[model samples]
Target: MSITRRGFLGASLAAAMDGWQPAAAAGARVTLDQLQPGVYVARAHNAEVARANAGEVVPTLVHVTGAGVLVVDPGPQAAWGGALLGAIRALTPQPVRWVVNTHAHPENVLANAALARLRPRPVFLASAATAALMRQRCADCLARLQAQLGRAAMRGTTIVLPEPALQAGGWLHTGATAWQVQVHDNAHSASDTVLYAPQLRLLCAGGLAYQERVPEMQEASLQGWRQALRQLAALPADTVVATAPGTPAQTLVPTLAYLDALASGIGAALAAGCDASHAIDAVAAAPFRRWRHFHARHPLNVQRAWRQLEDLWMQGEPLA
Candidate 1:
């Protein structure tokens, strides 16, 4: 058969699309930055989540000690979990003894099975509220994640429950390493928790801190979130781990400041009677030009924050 120039090019383009691959996400390469002697944080990408690799946008924290290793928020799939395990192996031969799921969001807690079924299963932990929330939502979450990231990207993934879910301030000891569990409500998520290593003065704020990008408030409470930020600031930990770029402390202030600004900005917009749908243009205006994902995330943040703030205003409750 004879083919025209356009036909040949179209055929080749179709084949390329059929066999498409994301070069940037070829493998899960989370950089391990050593915070102190034995503490490391595999920082995730601060930009938007993509079909390329959903888990690459989430960070994981690794703590090593004589007993074993402990990991925090191990990404969103079996693949990410395997990458985390390999990262752990490169650091130490010790098995992963514990995993702390800081929240129920898939970005933070979906890689349980990757390391749970090792020589000795790793004990996954979270706040009791989070465990209950995960048990209720994880099956749906897995299906949704598979749909969003594709079955191939989510292959071998399973929802592993965080066992022995402890209350707030519970002490979880893994060998010589001890993590003080600090859980807060309605902050970053319905159940938000931070792990504090008192000795190392390291705090893993999980979703509460966004060092680079504008904060996403889909499941957040502005008032409660601000209170939680204050609590996090008061903690003595010098080392902070957030999901975004920049150092922990540098990220900390801006994250809080952005949230405060977001709340007030939205509040003013609401008071001025801007429609919820159109408030994004007003609230997320020029001043936030410096933050990343302003256009991508600001509209959603404005919409969600407006509803909550409106509810509070109508009920005669202060927009805490």
Candidate 2:
């Protein structure tokens, strides 16, 4: 009951890996780094800067349990999932007992089937809100992933849901460890979930946060997301692990800064009577020009934030 996570995950590595055929086409390998004593993050390069590296690793967060592991955001595609499993095996012999999808993205949760096939089977966890988004967007999600990961790589990929899904701020206990789960709607995607281990001071902040990349808005609540970050910043936890495997939590400050800037820019543009397209274009300007996918992502963020601002303005919400 007093096992340190490093002891659990870094145990028995001499014979850790299962026999796995690495993806020759994807030409990528999932490598594990012990960020903390028991916490391992599987990451390749900055997929934000290089999407070709996106297939390299879907970037997952692993929590070491006594005889098992808890994974956050198991990557995209069956092949990537297989690679992720092998990476974990290299760290410990503990079976993956639970997987939490931060949101309804294929890159995060499509590997559920592969993990579900373990001997005792793993419990899949997600918010009911995220599950509903999966149901509504599964087909479209598959289509987009297939186009990105290629049809062959995605073979056997399916939508897997958490049974008895949590609503918000639910408790998940694994052996001697427990995680407080929080779910969000209109923050990142239609929904997002973050898991916090208070004892360990670690937070697996699903899609709610990003690093070294521009955050996208797929039915996002721009202002709501800002509020969510404010809440996360208030947490006593010092270390936060988001979907991006190797990035530091301190970078979250700039990411939050970017979102706030987008919101303020949209509000100012609207107040100045700039049209939606013009506002989006105007916001596509400076400071964020250096971010990955700035041109591609800025317009969408502006468009979404613009609408939310319009409604708030109509409701007499004060603008700064």
Task: Write candidate 2's Cα lDDT for 228-294 as tens digits.
Answer: 8878877777677774643335545767888888777778887887877776665635767777777
Query: In each prediction, how many residue pairs overlap at the backbone (N, C-alpha, C within less than 3 A)?
Result: 1, 4
Clashing pairs in 1: 223-320
- Lowest lDDT sum, 10 consecutive residues, model 2, at 1-10
Compose the digit string of candidate 1's lDDT tens values, residues 1-320. 11111101123322422432122233545457777778777756776556765656776888888788888888887667666665566677776778888888886777786666575677888888889899999999888888887777777778899974767878878777677888898998898888877877778888888865788888899888888888888878787887853455677777888777777877777677777765666564565667898877877887787788888877877653
lDDT value for model 2: 0.70
The pairs that clash in candidate 2 are 5-38, 6-37, 6-38, 186-221
Instruction: List ranges where model 1 is wrong by over 4 Å.
Output: 1-26, 245-248, 269-278, 281-285
Cα TM-score per model: 0.85, 0.85
lDDT of 1: 0.73
Q: Cα deviation of 302 in candidate 2 (Å)?
A: 1.8
Model 2 / residue 20 / CA error / Å = 9.1
